[model samples]
Target: MAATQYMTDGQGPTISMLAAGDASDMLSGYTLIEHLAQNKTAKVAQIGKLVDEQAKAHDQAQQKITDLQKEIKDLASQKKRIEALVKKYKPQSPSVGMGGVTPRMANVKTVIDQEEGPFPTIGCVRHTGDPQDHGTGHACDFMVTTGGVMATGAAKAHGDATAAYAIAHASALGIKYIIWRQRIYDLRSPGWRMMENRGGVTANHYDHVHISVF
Candidate 1:
């Protein structure tokens, strides 16, 4: 037998209490409830539509994220390339020059290094200011002293005059700036009148005849 429900007050418990107890009870026995059960086919159609919309939105969001990521990667690669080029072309030092090294000087150094074989173990090579400032990167200073005798100077085993001549000759052929022995002057020497008057002699050139291959 079905269980019988008990009534407490003069009237039964109010509908509000039933609603509070279970939300579904508020719709129980209503026409809307009856239709909800009868139209399961319509509910299925609505569910399909909601699922399609959600799938489309998800696909579009994924595509946008992929495109953004690809764009970021491409930009990063370009930035790295630009930075590498800058580093590669950057001057090693300020002494290299403002516009960088001149082709003439590069060629001269190459010739000197290759053709000269080896320089003196005791002697030093002198270099002047930037080529741009001097317009010739070929300026150098070398000295040969005898036991106070200029004639004995040639007998000493410095690089032969032939080697010196080769350097000078090659510089001339290559259009490199090379100050000849005669072109040099020692303004500090006793008869340095001409060079001092012309102001062509630097202090460093006073002890050694200045040679320059610009």
Candidate 2:
């Protein structure tokens, strides 16, 4: 009473018709496939479970990274706000006992150096031969860009901010006039007046913000 069976090599389950089973215990067709799949089912399931665990860990780590990045950005924003607040309400003291510069001009220089400046160059009390404000220690040139370069991008923006700040704080800083970007803002007139083109970056005050204090 012989029955059909399937034989296999070590590689995988393969069908080779062989008579090795009695009819009562024969494994063939659907029963044979079920028997073979059951042998490896536990191992396959274990490997899939490991893969799932690793994938979940990767996702968790990625979420943590994203959260930390957001935290850092938030902290940076808070720091900027705090710094701005400090600058806004901080009491300003005049530069005392300073020579070759007026007290008001020295205070302007001190404030700008502590805040917006550390500029490329700051020239004051220089010999202009015509007795302009520069020779009298009441003027300063806050050079935002050097090398006779016409300011663009960040330099131009910095110059604009410096000029605006000087204009805005003219009363407190005792600003007589501010010259920037070929225009002059005289506190007496309180208007921006265009000047004749001076043919160069330094001459036209394009690369520097000129401040003259009373």
Candidate 3:
């Protein structure tokens, strides 16, 4: 017998052919491609994260700048208010004493004499209206103050000296209506009145003489 001739041929490939195909090498290539794809995805993810971080940082910086600007504006407004308050609290000059009274009556006399001609020796200084004229002791008109020879409205017209001096000094001070109360007699007992009765109590004649200290 020919040594048990029952050997069978494999259906597909021989073991030698399978070995020649190098399965290990093909698997290595697939693995390399997969690794490369994964690396690319990781890189993309990292870039996205970096972009998001940068955007957040930019927003924070912008917000900080806006806040700083608002603070600066608020500080400026506060400074302005402080300046205004200081000005309001400032005291008046010694020239304009309390109640529109001038402390330097002598100085006023000299000024009036120099500007409006010789002042009368004895003049009347009465209030705009009358308590003496109406006899109401409480209706004190303009206040009067004296500085040597100079006289001015105090709150009640002191005597005849203050009103007389104020009226006489009006021209020098550019006083508006020296003639408003022309009926008011001077310290010298002479009456003065507005030459032209324009209207409404000669407009500029407030109760007190409108005098500027400067």
Candidate 4:
């Protein structure tokens, strides 16, 4: 039972207990007086050698246990990081009803959030007359950075990713066109073309991605 406990639970002994038992069994029949009377120096030397071997095996087992524990911890940390990424990229609901934007535009916002999202803000619908897409509730501005500031670093990367996603799924999302970083991808033309400079970052569509849906 003691040997079984050591092997199964790894908690009862130094794991060399089995070898010690075998050594004891080898000299079981001899009394203490008989052992002392007999010149059993060679036999005693063999038992000592057996003990040394068991000690080495025990040390090796302990080191293996330590290594396994560290591996388990590393795997757990990796799992946590993967879960965080999944949550960050998961699909989220867009404010479809709050803005006067069309359902197509709202669905596009949802798909972008699912693919490259969690944006700083999304603007749609304005009273600035002229009968444009925003005034007619057909356009949305997906902001990568807040307060109309120009995108940089991760924000710029995110805006680029959003524009790329829109271009890739333009047909499916019914996107008429997208403007970002002084460039435009028109569904009718089927290519990216540089838009004439419109002054600053906000005016030139560098601060946000503009999506117009049909």
Q: Tell me the tens digit of each residue's lDDT in model 2 across 90-148.
A: 65433222458888888888777567755876777777544389877898888888799
Per-residue error (Å), model 1, residue 206: 35
Candidate 1 wrongly placed segments (more than 4 Å)? 1-34, 96-214
Instruction: Estimate the overall C-alpha local distance difference test score of candidate 2.
Output: 0.78
- The candidate 3 region of ten consecutive residues with least summed lDDT is 131-140
- Write the number of the candidate with greater TM-score, choosing between 2 and 3: 2
Which 10 consecutive residues of model 1 have the lowest summed lDDT? 117-126
lDDT, each prediction: 0.42, 0.78, 0.42, 0.77
TM-score of each candidate? 0.29, 0.55, 0.35, 0.55
Segments of candidate 4 deviating more than 4 angstroms: 1-97, 129-131
Reference-based lDDT, residue 51, model 2: 100
Question: Which residue pairs of candidate 2 clash?
Answer: none
Candidate with the greatest lDDT versus the true structure: 2
**Per-residue alpha-carbon lDDT of model 4 for 118-173, expressed as tens digits?**
77677788766433788878888888876668899998999898998999999999
Write the residue-wise lDDT of candidate 1 on 151-214 in tens digits: 1354233334423554446535343322222342222221212322333222323223333433
Clashes of each: 7, 0, 25, 0
Model 1 lDDT vs. the true structure? Answer: 0.42
